[model samples]
Target: MMISHGFKSSKKDFSFGPWKVTTAKNHIMKSKDIERLTEDLNLRALPEMLFGDNILRIQHNDGFGIEFNAIDALKRINNSDDTLQVACAQQWQESRVVSEHTQEVVRPYDWTFTTDYRGTLIGEEMQMKVTETTERINLEKLRAREQIVFFDEVLLFEDELHDHGVSMISVKIRVMPTSFFTLLRFFLRVDGVLIRINDTRLYHESVPTSLFTDPNEIAQHLAFKLRLCEKLELPEQKQGAVNEDLK
Candidate 1:
């Protein structure tokens, strides 16, 4: 899934008429720390449930919003080298090119974008080894694997509305399944990197003002949704994942 953040502001036009309006645009990059934080998050474990934790925390900027699958796992890699393969899945969006040579751009998938901060080394060959920098490593692609933290449901608070807040959104993912490859006891390799994930729904959406009367209404609506979100459960196969905590 992909998330984009933008700030809204009003524009005044007296000639046409007086109206309350807003516009949003992509925020530009200003800090090198964004890159570091993105890398840390890529290697960091995903919470059991989506929307859990400050998953989108930035060093200097306030997170405007995040768009993720309210439906299913965006992608899954099944191969001999589960360790290396899974790490790539978390870091990069997959693409296919006719040649590994220069001057050929693979057609990008519309359903997804590359969340991977690092470039892909799917077709390359490398020796695998453990390193202190990462709890688990995807040396086949020369990268690190992440551990899975507890899955949680994220709730957005809105105070300007009613007693019943609106449910902003709901998201979840299989965290333990992600961290399983990190166990040093198991080592594996991959001949190529494969990405097979697509969002069934739009990755990003705009909240409608008509959904609630005021900020309080939005808050109450979200409160109700959060409670319902808590009922969500990962499948039985996705339970009890364990990994070494990051130092």
Candidate 2:
């Protein structure tokens, strides 16, 4: 079965709108060793996969967006034995509200821009870039109001992955814009089954807006799928995945 993992943040039920946005720092561990992790995760070089090679482009609905290109920067890291550090950025529309006007005008009140870092032998880092752009009569005014906010950790990915016959991933995530809660997620892919786990902790939050999936439950489901796949004995195929949805 095919599965796509997307960004998830935990927040209070009452927290709403742009101000309620939360960032997360996750420890992403894949099922590859340090020497092979980059290749296995398709992050060996910068601009490797996901959303194509261009860093700046228009989205499906005519939304403008941009991301960092790390190809040249990563080449240096690959050539050197020393530790590497680099920053990547992305800006996109998080959500939008439709206007009552007859024309197709969308008033976007929430946008998310982030700067992220990935290293060969170190944990990942991320910073959310916030811009206060008002949707007024003059569109030019709204376009020029982009700015940077205080730097903070939003997402973290571990450089290494543990083995379990299949690729296993461990991730820790926290709410962004406003820190509300955190989540520890585990993922395992074997044959055609995908297993997911979410361990959550609430902080000053009344109700959880995210769903929690138990690791044990995932384990059982994974076990069943493995058996089923084995029984079916389908031929193995190799394929590549890109982050097209993000663009």
Give the winner by TM-score. Answer: 2
Per residue, candidate 1 scores C-alpha lDDT tens digits across 1-247 of 1233222322221110111111122223224543453354442212112221221110111212222221111122121122332333322323333346754433223212212221111112332232345232334421334344323322211111011111122223212322211110111122243433222211111234564677864663252333333466777775686898898
Question: Who wins the lDDT comparison?
Answer: 2
The total number of steric clashes, by the backbone 3 Å criterion, in model 1 comes to 27
The list of candidate 1 runs beyond 4 A from truth reads 1-24, 39-195, 202-247
Residue-level lDDT for 58 in candidate 2: 11
Full-model lDDT, candidate 2? 0.26
Number of clashing residue pairs in every model?
27, 12
Residue 84's lDDT in candidate 1: 30
